[model samples]
Each structure stands twice: as C-alpha cells, then as structure tokens.
Target: MKTGAGIREHGATVIVAALSTLFASTLILGTGVMTAALDPDLIESSGTFRMVLLMVSAVFIVIALYVGAIVTANTFATIIAGRTRTIALLRLVGASSRKVRSRVAGEGLLMGALGAGIGWVLAELLILAAVTWGPGLGWLPAGREYPRFDPLTVGAVGVVALTTWAAAWAGSRRVGSVSPIAATGAAVELRPDAARGRTARTVWSIILIILGAVFLTLGLLLGMLTPLALLVAFFGGLLSFTGIALGAHIIMPPILRLTGTLLGQGPTGRLAAANAVRFPERSARSTIGLVIGVTLVTMFAVALETYGSMTQIAFESDPALAAALAETLAITTAVFTGLVGFSAIIAAVGMVNTLSLSVLQRTRELGLLRALGFTGGQVRRMVIAESCQMTLAALGFGLLLGVFYGWVAAQSLLGSQAGFAPPTIPWLVVSGIVVFGFILAVSAAVAPARRAIRVSPVAALAVD
Candidate 1:
C-alpha cells in the first residue's frame, strides 16, 4: 500500500530501530568472528576475557534496544496525537479503538521488520568490506579467517521487531480516549490541567521514584563489598529515569517557563513560551528524547573522569599502575562514547521530526497570528524561540541527571578500592555539549520556522 506523510514522518523511528539492530548485530557477529580467528589454545585459556566480551556486548545490546523502544514509542505517540481527527472520525463511523490500535501496531511491526532487514544487510556489507580490506591494510592478521554469517545476529532482528510492536501498542493508548464527538471539533491537545488529571500516572511515577531511590542507596552501601553493586545501581537509574519520563508533563513545564524567560519578554518570545506550555504533553514528548541522549553522553564522561581520578589517587604510590589505569580508562571511554553517540543521533532525528510536526499542527494558530498583524519574521522567531526553550530545558535536566547517575555508578563500582571521592567534572565535555546543543537547537528550528512562516493566513484559517 502507498504510504502517506504520517508514515513518512515515522522515518526517525525506523532509522532508530535500524541503527539499534545494526549495532547489536555488529557487536554479536564481530565478537564471534574475532573469537573464531583466535588460536584454540588461547580461546580455551581466555574464559574470563570471553565472558567479559559477552557481558559488554549484552549490555550494549540492551542499551540499544531500550533507547530504540523509547524513541519508537514517543514517535508513535506524537503521530497519534496528530491523527486525533482521523481517529475521532473512525470512531464516529463505528470503528472500535481496539481495531484502530491494532492497525497502528501492525504498521509498527512492518516498519520494524523493514528497518531490521536494512540494518542486517548494512551490517553484512560493512563487515564484509572491513574483513576483506583490513588484512591488506595491516589492521588484522593476514591469514586470519572471518565468518560471513552468524545465526545469533538474526535474534537481534526478531527482538527489535517485537519490541517495536509493543512500543507502538503502548503509544496508541491515546486512541482509546478519543471520543466520537471530537470529530466535530478541531484537534485539541492536552492542557496543563488536563495533564495533571492523570492522577494514577503521577502516583505511579512517585512510587517508582521512591523505589529507585531505595535501590540506589542499597547499591551504594553494598559497593564496599563487591562491584556487583553496579547492577543494583543500574536498575535504580533505569527506574528513576523511567519515572521521570512518565511524569515529564509535570516536570517539564517549570523548566520551559524558566528557559522561556531567557528568551526575553518580546511578543514573539511570550507567544513561543505560552505555546510550549500550552500543550504540556507535546513539549515533554519533544524534549524527553534529547534529555535521554544528553544524560547518557554526560554520564559516561563523568563516570570515566571520576574513575580515572579515583584510581590515580588510590595508586598514588605506584605511578606505573596509575598510568596503566589512565590508559585503560581512556580507551574504554572512547569506545563507550562512540557507542552512545548512536543514541544521540536518534534523539536528534526525533527532535527534528517533533518540531516539524508541531509546526504543521499549528498552521491554524500561526495563520491567526499572522492575520492579527504578526509579521513573517515574528512568526519565524516564535518558532525558533520555542525550539530553543525546549532545547535549553532538555540540556539542563539532562546534565543534572547525567552527573548524578555517573557519580552513583562510579561510586558503586569503585568505592571499595578508592573510598568515596568527589565526582571529577569533565568541564570540557560539558562545555562541548552546551555548544552543540545551541547548534542543534538552531539547526532543528530552521525548517520548522520556515514552514510556519510560509503558512498563508487565509488558507490556514480555512483549514479544518
């Protein structure tokens, strides 16, 4: 079947899923090939090394899948919000919400399968090219053999497809709430009061946060005994973050208001700020993906810096051991930063997509403003202001989360050997993040601002 703009808008979701699958497949297949090429004696003797490899690959796969699922779910939720009119109309024609939701989930499954296939093919080509050329380039041993296929890689594809389907189903929950009467009116978004009315969600979020805090404390206390404390801390971070995400509508508005103030009190700035807070859910959805991305990057940087500092301090008498620790930490940090970069890219795609959809949905509002003496420049500035406000809010929240999580992780893993130490702030990385965020805000706004400015007042006002 031919696809519409709605389907096309899901390009980010597909790309995220594809990237996740590709990364996971490459990790799994690459490990297998490298192990296969090793001497049998070495392989048998290196059980600990092999186990560590497996654990690292598994951790990364989980991270990829988790990030992919969140992005996909958010994308679907945004798409469904835009389709409120269509869904209401379907309801008016007697179509059940279950059927509508099922249809959306099915589309998710198909898109996931398509993305997974693309990722698999890309992985194959990438590995093939690397393996074929690396020997000649002296990157690998000349006589080593690399396998062309691994059955384990296929599991990643299936897992991604199923996860996407589940995420879509979760995202489509809003469809059930759309009444047939909504078909007669213009599409509406959830206001602050309406958002606050989700008392059950708020309560659950609080409960999760409390539980997460407990787990984090336990992990810290246990850190003196074993590195396994990190496992507890990981679950704590995940739960707390999930709770924050669930309650973002509540958490984001204040931050948006604060950031909006930074944009000055100009008419355009006021309008932009009001628009951002007007639909709390929309603004939250727009910024949460970015929050996840920044949090991850900052977390790793802080963790590595903290680890390095503590190790150096602990081994102050042994310069050689300290130097080795520094070298190892640097290499590990580089590898992790590259891996986490994929999630950042996914978040960028999501931010751009959300901004574009927001502009498209606000056509009537933009037209009204234009008709009421707003200039094209004013309209454009308004859109840009809104985008900047969201970006600022995400950056602040993400950095805070990252630092806390990073400190907890480092302390949990190293407190026994190094004792409690202050988190080593990576000022350079933080500054770079701030600079890149500004650039991202501006770049993401350009297309949406242009689209908003191009809306003809007369035509837009006439639109349903």
Candidate 2:
C-alpha cells in the first residue's frame, strides 16, 4: 500500500529515479562503446587495456553518482513533505518514530528498486531499437553494428538504487519532526526561518562571489596552467555557481516584485504577486530547478558566442577560416549545451510537483475566493501569477550566473592565448530560454489550476 501510494501520488518524483538509472545505463553504454573502438589499437601498442577501461568507467561513475544523488535528494524531500498527514497518522497509531522512519525508508527502497529495474529495461530496449534502426535514424555511422552489452550494467543499477536509499533515508527524518496530530490541527507550514535564510544566503553568497573573483584575478594575473591557476579557475567556476544559487533566494522577492510589477499591472497581476510572496517558501522552492538548468544552458551559450566572436576577429583577414571556425564552434557548442540542458527536465518536474502540492494545500482558500464571487478565471489567474513570479526569479538569477560563469570559463581557458578578441555574448539563446521558462511556468500550472478551480467554494469550506 505504501509503495503504491508513493508511485501513484508522486509520479513525477519517480521519473527522477528512472532518469537517474537511464543516465547510469548511458554511462555504462558509453564506456562499452569506447572499449570496442579503443581496445584493438591499445592492445597493438602493448598498453594495458584494463586501466584505460577503469579510467573511463570512473569518470562516468562520478557523473552518474552526482546526478543521482541530487535528483533523489530533491525528489525525496518533495515526497516527505507531501506525506506529512500519512506519517502523522502512523505515529498517532502507536508506530514508533523509528518504525515510521523505517517505513518511509522501506517505501523508498521499493521505489528505488522499481525505478532502477524499469530504467535499465527501458535503456536496454532503446539500445536494441537504436541498433536495429540506427542507420535509418542517423544515430550512428551507416552500416555500423549495434553496441554490445557490458558487464557494468549491473553496477549501474546498484549505483542508482543505493543513491535513492541514501536520499530517502535522509529526507524521511522530517517525518519524525511533525506532530502526530499535525493534520488534525491547523496546518503549520514548515519554513526555514526567513531572517536566518536571508543572513546565511547573504554571507555565503558574498563569500563565494569573492572566492570566485579571487580565482579569476589570480588566473588572469598569473596566466598559467599551473596547479594554483587550475585550482583557482575550477573553484572559481564552482564557487560562482554555488554563490548564485544561494544568493538567488535572497534576491528572489525583489526580482519577483519587479517582474510582477512590470508584467502584471491589472488586479489579477497584483493578486498574483501578492499570492506568490505570501508563501515565500513555496515560491522559492519552485525556482530551484529553473535556476540550475537555465544557468548552465545560458552559460555554455555565452561561452560559445564569445569564442566565435574571438575567432572571427582574429581571422578577419581570412573570412573563410573565420566562418568555418565559427560554424564548427556553433555546432559543437549546441551539442554540449544540449547535454547540459537536460537539467531542465528536473526543473520542469519539480515545478509541476510544487505547483500541484501548492494547489492541494490551498483547496479551501481557493474555494473561499470562488465563494466570495471571484470567478474561476480569477483563481486560475492567481495560480498563473504565482508561476510567473517563480519563473521571473529563476530567469533573473539564471541569466546573471550564466553571464558571469560563461565569461569566467572563457577567460580562464582562452585568456593565455593572445590575439583573441574580447568575449561576446549572444543574447538570442538567453531570450529563448526566458520564453521557454515562461512557457514551462505556465504549463506547470494547468493541472493544478484545474484542480483548484473545480472545487466549489461551499464544499471546500465545509470540508475544511
């Protein structure tokens, strides 16, 4: 029953589990492909193939592990939040806190195993289909054979399964914090303390930004690929990403207000802004996914644009070479950016879950609005407003981080090479992402808004 409830209610979260497994499977497949292509040459040269294989596998493992950990952690947090009522009931019925936590963990284990298995199967099926139709589909070189299975597939499943368990175990502790009668009593939204949130964000943001600045300064000053410079450049990039994420929340409310003021001028727009800020936690949480995805995508886009411009300027005497370099770079950048763009899938799923959960939490409030003669359209508009506010917050911060990170990457990697023109940003991709973010924001609200507007005011009030 517990497993079924989780699967039924938290379908979006489950998709994360599956995607984790898929990524892992892809990693395994990737190494296997490399092994097939590289083994014969390495063997002829008298090099040890096993070590090379291990190195390749290790890189993919780290990437898959990182992706799995974050996805599962965020997902399980959502699941735990939504299950507050059921957990409270379990506790009230003499279930020990340990027992409650164990149950949640067990449920997560079941979910993890299921998702891993399903993802592995789906990935294998995709591989098979790709192999069979790859030539026609243009996924591979013409007449190339399908990739063979690798032994590491089992390990990939294990990796994702373990990640899910760890995330679930960590997030389930929240179950113990809620009172047994949490649902019976008035709903006490568990929010991080606002002052502390702001203060911590501010301090951390400044620290990271400074750290990143130091790295850039040192890299620019020393202008070498030494250990210190590499460390500075790498850490600078990481620190900038971290700082932006932390500081985003601090700046969110103001950005949201500005976005709301600019985009929404009517009564509905005002209501949307008011509703969004009213629940600071929800609004803030909803933006996390968009921020990361948009940031990475925009960051790469900017870096490529800058590089292309530099090449063009450097080779202006030979327009053919300049155009060729720019075209090649554009294609390469698009491919790389597309890979990173997968981060948005998590954001979209989180947005939908957040919005749905929000709707569920405010059933009676929405009904009250309807009862007070506010039309259903008005309620819908309010939800749309909330989405817009979150979207705006995401874009403001995402673009900011993208610009800084992209410039840092360009300078760090290409700065030593003389005769390159200054960095140039292509705003077109950023503009598209804004529209994409907006659409994602609005689309996420559809089902939730429908659920909210359908509840009759009198019925909702009575039930509450």
Candidate 3:
C-alpha cells in the first residue's frame, strides 16, 4: 500500500511538470510558426531596434519555457530517486527494473498523451473558429485561419513524452542502488550538494555572461536580430545570472547591510532583505526566470508602443480620423500590453512560487514564528514583499529599456517630427499598467504564503 502511494505521488509530480513544460513549449513553437508565416519581412530584413527586440524576446520566451520544462523534469527525476527503496522492494519481489521503469515511464507517457490531445483539440478548435470567421470579419487574411496539422507537431509531442520518460528512467538508477532492506527502513536521506562548482563552470559562466550582454546589446542596436543571436543571448544571460548568484553568495551579507541603509527599513523589511540577499542560489534562480519573463515583457511593451505611435502618426495625417486615433491607440495598447504583461506575470509568479516552495519546505524554523504571534497574514505579507521588491526592480530596468526602444521607433516612423525634444510619455497609462501588475503579483503570492504559515510548530522543530 505504501509503495503504491509513493509511486502515485511521484508520478503525479512528473505528469504535472511534464504537462506544463509541453504546453509552454508548444506555445513558443506555435507562435514562431505563426509569426514566420504571417510576417516574413519582419522576421527577415527589417532590422530596427524594436524589431530586433521583438524577435529576440520571442526566442528567449521559447528558451526559458524549454529550460523550465527540463528543470521540472529533473526535479521529478530526483523525486523518483527518493522512492528508490520502493522500486528496489518491487524489484526483489519479482519485478524487473525494466518493468518498474516502464510503469514510471508509462505514467508520464499517459499524461503526456492526454496533454497533447487536449492541446491538439484546442488548436483545432481555434483553427476552425478562425476559418469560419475569417471571411465575415474582413480583417483576417483569406484562408489564413485554416490551421493544418503537421506531422512535425506530432513528432514534437512524441519527443516531449520521450524526454520525460527518459528522465524518469535515468533517475531510476538510484533504484538499483537501493538495498532491498529499504522496505523496513526510513527513506535514505540525500544531502544537498555543497556549494562547489568546477573552474570550468566558472569560466563558462563568465564567458556566457559577457557573450549574452554583447549579443543582447548588439541585437538591440542592429535591429536585425537572428534566432541564433537570440539563442546565444538567452543561454548567456542564464549563465550570467548563475555567475552573479555565485558571486553574490560571497558578498551578500555586506551588500544586505548596505542596502538596508538605503531603505531605512524596519525589522520586517530588513529580514526580508536579508533573506533574499543572503541566499544567492535561491535568489538567483527565483529571480532569473522573472528576469527572462520581464525582459520579454519589456521588449514587447516597446514593440507595441512603437507600433501604436506609428499607427497614430498615420491617423494624425487623416484629419477625419485624428479624433479617433487616441481612442484606438489607447485600446490597442491596453489589449497588447495586458496580454504581454500577464504572460510575464504568470512566469514571474511561477518562478517566485518555485523559490517560495523550496524555502517553505526547508525552513520549518519559520513555523515557530507562526506560533510566536506571527499571524498567517503577516507571514504571507513577508513573502509577498520579497516578490514585490524583485518585480519592481525588474520593472525599473524594463522601463528604461522601453524608453530607449520607444524613442528609436518613434524617430524611425516620424523622422522629421523626431528631434532633440524630450519624448512625452502617457504617465497615467503607464501607472495603471504598473499598478495592475503589482496587484496581480500580490494576489498570486497569497496562497503559497498562507501554506507556509499553516505548517504546524511541531513540524518546524523536527527539521534537522
């Protein structure tokens, strides 16, 4: 009974993780295919800073999604390792490792199949709807909505399923290592590896950071971003963040103290700052995904801004439509910005929760605080504060980039009108978007923080 329970638990994790990964990947891939088909020129020759930003951001979105999926798969693999004893017991009781592996793999395959089917059905429904509405709308391209299913999509789904199963199979090596006597004992403890990486890893990290910054800068400057350049920048930025985290680990204490001076923070804020600054690996991984997501969100903001500004220019030339331009631009920006921003928020929230889950799982010590008058509300508030701080920092960087890109795009469109004059921003509009994002981030943090608070004090003290 226990063995079945353990299998079921790990299996569920694998399935959920796999489904998420596949869905994200499909979106990325499908978007690319659609863009290439719809806007070949934009994908090719038009090398503007904003265009480069769009292309690079799209590529990064795909990379981040795939990387996240792999990480989830790895975690699922590790969890399966935790159940090695159960596997060994089954092996000793006349099951082959191959058979045990099959069961694990089969569970993932089943989930993958279901997820892929659902995705396909959704795609087909969308395609059908597009086809049906295409002519009546007059806004859509003729027959453009008819989405044909390619064998490649099916192959891609198969690859996702296979990759997931392979991860489980590889992790099952721990099963072979387990003693059959594990059936009578507690699960073996696997210590977290020490904070050590090789010289090669450090060198690679530095190289990647440098290269990523260069490609990202160049892509923005040249306005002609290729997929290759975006891929390099994506991986490079990821490695760079890893290096930053490692370096931060050494400097965090002093840095935290210095930052506290700037904030003039109270005890609660200070603690939050210390917690985030002190833990380099946690902070880096937690925020890295957000950085990627926010970077894309920011770039998309610039693209939409540029597009709207140009559309407004065209509208301004039309004396009859001049009055309508503001309303149209307002509506378009609202819709596009909301879509792009919400996607980033989802990614950011996921990353934040991933880190929060790890923290809550490890820090049973915090449960004692819940007993010491730290209401669940207070605890939740603290966790959210950390997320909000990181998000705001990201938002600042994004806004700066957006300003630059928006200016360049505006100049390109309204060449003569563009001068040394300072660009006027729609402050109220920008503020509304920022406020909406903050509200969403805060709302998302609530459930996880509450879960942390609810852990019993007994559980807190029991941690090693």
Each prediction's RMSD over C-alphas, in Å, is 1.8, 4.1, 8.5
The TM-score of predicted model 3 comes to: 0.58
Best by TM-score: 1
User: Tens digits of per-residue lDDT for model 1 on 296-356?
Assistant: 9899999889989989987999999999989999999989988887777777777877777
Runs of candidate 3 exceeding 4 Å displacement: 1-117, 132-148, 159-200, 215-265, 303-346, 371-377, 397-433
- CA lDDT of 330 in candidate 2? 78
Ranking by lDDT: 1, 2, 3
Count of backbone clashes, every candidate in sequence: 0, 0, 2
Ranking of candidates on TM-score, top first? 1, 2, 3
> By lDDT, is 1 or 3 better?
1
Give the distance in Å from residue 271's predicted Cα in candidate 1 to where it truly belongs.
1.0
User: Against the hidden true structure, what lDDT does model 1 obtain?
Assistant: 0.85
1-464: candidate 2 lDDT, tens digit per residue: 35654454457556766776776676566545544444344646423454575665564455445444544555555566666676677778888877877876776677778878888888788766766676577655464344657667778777677777786787566667777878564333445355335575589888997887787777655543432454466677777666755565455666677777765577677878876666454565567667777777887888778767656665788999888887899788876666566555655666666667667667777888888888998889788877877788788888887887776666655555434345577777888898888888888887788877887888877643
lDDT of the candidates, in the order given = 0.85, 0.67, 0.51
What lDDT is reached at residue 9 by model 3?
A: 40
Q: How many Å off is the CA of 202 in candidate 2? A: 7.5
Write down the lDDT that model 2 would get: 0.67
lDDT of 3 by residue, 1-464 (tens): 35754443444334434444444444444443354345445645433533554554555434443443433343444444345557767867888767776776676566555555555555555555645675578645454433445454465556555655564565344455566767654334333132233345456656665765665464433333222333433444455444543343232334334443443376557666666555444444355445444544554555455545655565566766755766776686675565455445445544544444544444454676666776666666667776666556545544554555444444333433322223445565457547755675576466667766667767765643
Per-model TM against the reference: 0.96, 0.82, 0.58
Instruction: Extract clashing residue pairs from model 3.
Output: 47-223, 48-223
